[model samples]
Target: MSNFTYRKDHIPKGTACNRRPGFAMKPTTITIHNTANEKSSAANERAWLTNPSNKVQASYHIVIDEREAIECIPLNENAWHAGDGSGSTSGNRTSIGIEICESGNYTKTIDNAVMLVAQMLMERGWGVDRLRRHWDWSGKICPRLMYDGGTWSKWYAFKAAVQGRLNELKKEGVASVSDKVTVKAYGKQIKDGKLIDGTVYVPLRAVAEARGDQVSWDNNTKTATIYK
Candidate 1:
């Protein structure tokens, strides 16, 4: 459990909500980005995060807004976040992407994002070498508004900053991870290798075995559950 939380309900509060993706595994990297549209109200943002088939459906795992650490997609399964297309993580590779909600040039949000990412990295036992920007791998220019002023000349400096934050979080020592998951019969969820959230979605019988859970479904309730 991560102790990232806001003292109160407010954007920019930098609250870290601990949400178990209901899976298990070590995360490889952390991908950060910004949401172009403005979702001021909690209800609107919640709807956008939960709705499947929407333009932004099943894309990112964590949606960190003004003061929320809304975990949308499951962590163990890939949520199509990085890579301009599929080539980047095409072969069932994985990464954790955090999409910060902001219209443009959001500095404070970026600060919180950076801090949160560093904390996550430290928690996941990832090295600084694993830390990367979308552009670093796919050569894309997302999270454009998060830049201090479009001056990437200080790339090394930014890296240093996140590293420091990561180091600090490591010292405190309070974070968690999910490595695998089980899906119900006739109901599976994975975006690429990442898992998306939805009722009666894809099938993951294969993964269920690896997760040590025998898949079953209660026809009456149409429900599925996995016990450690």
Candidate 2:
């Protein structure tokens, strides 16, 4: 489990003209954005999104800061952060928005976002390819700090950091392996491991024999025994 605090302060269900409209989505991708307001905390962003007077039709799913992550909108519902509107395959319709706050400690905020995105991808059995930038959808230089004058070095590094965290999470056994996973044991590599219900299963006999252990099969008992 992550140490970061996660809170859900969703918008009310029947708000006439606020931000969220209850539009349903499957969220095939994750869109990253920078709040660009260095003074706002995660809680402040949540408050603004859920406030009655904020008439802007802009919103996001998760807002992260140095201290906590707040969910302003549900993941199953679309947010208006992406400028591409609600067309099919548009980022607003198909992506989960994550706005990283630049208040307090910016590096810690980004680290939290990396962990959060990694966890989401692991839960959905998705790869880093599903992660997107706000610019990818509508050509807006959002998450602008990472863009760095369009050099994209920071953006690439951010994605690499998220993928690294995802690998660590998978190694911790928190996520199932959807694709073929290579198993290495005792300095030997096994490639043909069976994938059963997201778990990798290797042949017992093959592994034991490779380790120089004697393997015996008892037909009557229907048991396989390994003798070292």
lDDT of 2: 0.83
Locate the minimum summed-lDDT window of 10 residues in model 2: 173-182
lDDT of every model, 2 decimals: 0.53, 0.83
Candidates in order, TM-scores: namely: 0.55, 0.74
lDDT of 2 by residue, 1-228 (tens): 335877678887665354787888888999999998989999998888767787788889989998898887888888888999779788888899999998898888888888888888897888999989999999999889898889978899999999999999889867632246577877788776765323478889778867889789999999999999
The residue pairs in collision within model 2 are: none
After superposition, the stretches of candidate 2 with alpha carbons farther than 4 Å from their true spots are: 16-18, 176-228
Whole-structure CA lDDT of model 1: 0.53
